[model samples]
Target: MKNLDLFDPRSVMDSDFSLNVSGGDSDFGFAFNDSNFSDRILRIEIMDDAPENRPDSEGCTSIADWARHRKRRREDIKKESVLDLTACPEEQILNCDQPDMEDCGDCGNPDEEAVAMSEESPSGDEAGNSNDSCWSMDSSTVVRVKTLHISSPILAAKSPFFYKLFSNGMRESEQRHVTLRINASEEAALMELLNFMYSNTLSVTAAPALLDVLMAADKFEVASCMRYCSRLLRNMPMTPESALLYLELPSSVLMGDAVQPLTDTAKQYLAARYKDFTKLQEEMMALPLAGVEAVLSSDDLQVPSEDAVYDFVLRWAKAQYPKVEERREILGARLARFIRFPHMSCRKLKKVLTCNDFDHDVSTKLVVEALFFKAEAPHRQRILAAEESATFNRRYIERAYKYRPVKVVEFELPRQQCVVFLDLKREECVNLFPSGRVYSQAFHLGGQGFFLSAHCNMDQQSSFHCFGLFLGMQEKGSVTFAVDYEFAARSKPTEEFVSKYKGNYTFTGGKAVGYRNLFGIPWTSFMAEDSLYFINGVLHLRAELTIRH
Candidate 1:
């Protein structure tokens, strides 16, 4: 029955699938759909549990069989004896009963005595004890002494190299581990560097040494010390002179190396002192142009025309000026405003004054006119030539304008009147104007009342009027209003007051003040009979006025 079942296609497919038959005599075998023959065989081995019908074993070994074989072989061998172990014990353990005679007789223990003796001995002392007596007479004796001469363990622990270097008296006398020298510099720099090295801090009051210390710290590779020094240097306030010097330093040094050291206050200091630098630069430029020509032409070469002399000096000074902006500013400030007229040669002056607004030409013209009016003939020909030149330039401009036909228009303002009065009633008729062109109005009230009234020309093309309205309210609920009026005339007409109002107004304490006007009417008028009301112990009133242009 089972063989018949195996013949069925479904039963054969479901049976343990195998691609290869090992022990069975079948030459051909069914192939499985999946290619994994080892897994298929493993599944067959798992399902075939019956001893007689189990899958034929081809190349397989049991772990228990191998272990039993190994156990039987191991059991046939003999174990070695460990009772007579040849390992040697330490010398101290071997001589435990023997009294340690390395120390003095009264010493509690040899090790302790040796340690005490080593500590008490001087740095170079080697005769404190001898180990020769304990050793065989024929055996050679070797002595070892280890000495650490560190004075302070804490300092030594920080840096063993430093500790060792100082411990051996290497830093004794003037031959210290670190040496600093300031060459031809102010004492401040030397002091600052010294303070940083010794105490890692600088005196707050030391001015000159502050920056110098920073430079020194950067030179030395002491990171922690340099950080503290940099902080102190950054905090120091610089005077104007120092600030200028600071600005003159190398750009690389200022921007790259020391930029982080700068504080906001220091930056402000530099800004404030910028003018001094500007002046300095100007002076440097001005001096050379002053008298260089005269100096070149002088017989003595030393005493030239004041201009030439000034020019030479300035040129020489400018050549020596630093290239930095701060230095340039100093030079500029000094030279720019300095009076260069006295030292200016006539030729130079002419060249400079050739511009439309030449100072020399103006001054020369004034001098010539003074001479002519005084009946002095100093240089009549020169004076006449300058006068003609001036007249020609003026006429040239005038002709150019005439040919271009550029019109010049003038604007007229409206007439205004302001009036102030004291203790005037709120509804009183303060003043009156006859029927005329009412252009604008404004008012203000404070300690004194202020009012403005403007009248404009009705025939103008376009006109505008502005006014200020200010009102002050008293504790008694009484109010005062003041106004100011301004009128402007223009070519383009704006919308009449009939359409829009053109003014800003603000009201406080429930009181209002503003200009009022109406257009398309016969005339603008203000009446004193306007209504007034009182609410919540506050006075409410309406003041209306009509203005026409």
Candidate 2:
């Protein structure tokens, strides 16, 4: 019986009160003839027919029926009220029948609004009242009905829905009877929601029950109850099952800001649980669109490169949507934005243009955008990444890739040469502690592709842990090419690129060449703050390669 009053602070501190002084065990603490309430009746009609049993009831009996009923009921009531107003001006009609409450013309006359003893319907014309014609059009449709004496003023104070229904100058507003139609599944939740409107508390604490009440509150436009339910659900133990359920809530519920925190938490949980996409490929593929989006949206996903992410997205899309058109639509619309095109390999980007899964115009635009981003200067690219970070645009954000992105500037004048720049954040370099290797994206020189690799390994000469760098040809078992290459790095005090190694090698396909310990210092000293190497949390290295005649 946890009571959370999110709307009014006073309601939180106030003691709970019962609707009936007699302590009745009814669904709502409803008691007739009590002076503490108003002279109005709330008739909740429950349609208990199962979906398969009722021809008119759609498969979504609970939601579709409840929503259609609410909308149609309001419209019908307003239209009838307007007709009644036109037919009889300057007259307030109170249409109450039944034994517990009496109908009256004058609201101020207590004698006319007297309380009776029996529970029975009026006969003849009174029973065939035109006001109930629309609701009772299909008598068999309504399986059960529950009548309760409710205070319009009290309900209106808590929900705008009731306020508009009761105060909107409608004949139904002036009338003593108000009818609400809902399915049998909504019976308990609707009752809980009504009780909450009166007491600002809920007796149901379980997650599933609270969620049901939350949906009911949303249907009835009770913001406070939704917030209370969201808070209660958030406090309960969350599982992947429950998290996915929260994320998959109806769009109508998600539209409200009150449930946003709950969804955000769900997305975060899914993202963290599946941060390593490589390890959970099958599981991630099995996730629905929302869950996949949650995982891919995170900047923390661990993969080899953006190419792998693109592969996974394609595989998942293909598996989920065997139809080519639907697959293209989903990838182009929902999933494409999560793939960091700017960070993908050039070879992969080329393949993207020919990929049939993406719309031609969309894939072209993305490739052009990625190329433009790659063409920008290093500092300009950093600025763009920083700017896009504010909006959480995943295209510009770099994930933890096993192969880091690099910048390469090619030149034809120096006998076909290229200067490759590899910048590793201080933390990234730190992650290479003891013995770890990180490779850079491939660059082109002399019509051949090459890559830069950084490592932490035991120095062959000193037999101590030291930073290492290497140059490798992307091709394997191919024609050999002789090249002179130089490695340089920016150091403290000067912060200028200082040449470290100068050598020539006849590189065969699949062969690599470089010094084991380029810095010629122990790993600890090279990584120490105020060390000659790192500049402003970045380890900048440059490799210049020139084709030999």
- Compared with the true structure, all predictions reach lDDT values of 0.28, 0.71
**CA RMSD of all predictions:** 39.2, 8.2
Over 4 Å off, model 2: 1-35, 51-140, 253-255, 410-417, 443-450, 461-464, 473-482, 492-496, 507-511, 546-549
The digit string of per-residue lDDT tens for model 2 on 1-549 reads: 011111221221232432331122323334333323544666665554444322221232333343344343333323221122224433322232323334433222332343432233334463335344323333434555566656565566556566655565644455566666565656788788888876667998766667778877776677778878888878877667677777766535333887888888889999999988779778888888999999999998888889999999999999999999999999999999999999987778999999999999999999999999988865677789889888967688899887798877778984788888888988988989888889998888877889899999998865689999999999888679899999999875465789999899998789999989999889999998878687667788999999999
* lDDT by residue for model 1 (302-372), tens: 22233443344445544755444433453344432232332233334344334322244444653344334
Query: Lowest summed lDDT over 10 consecutive residues: which window, candidate 1?
Result: 37-46
Report clash pairs, candidate 2: none
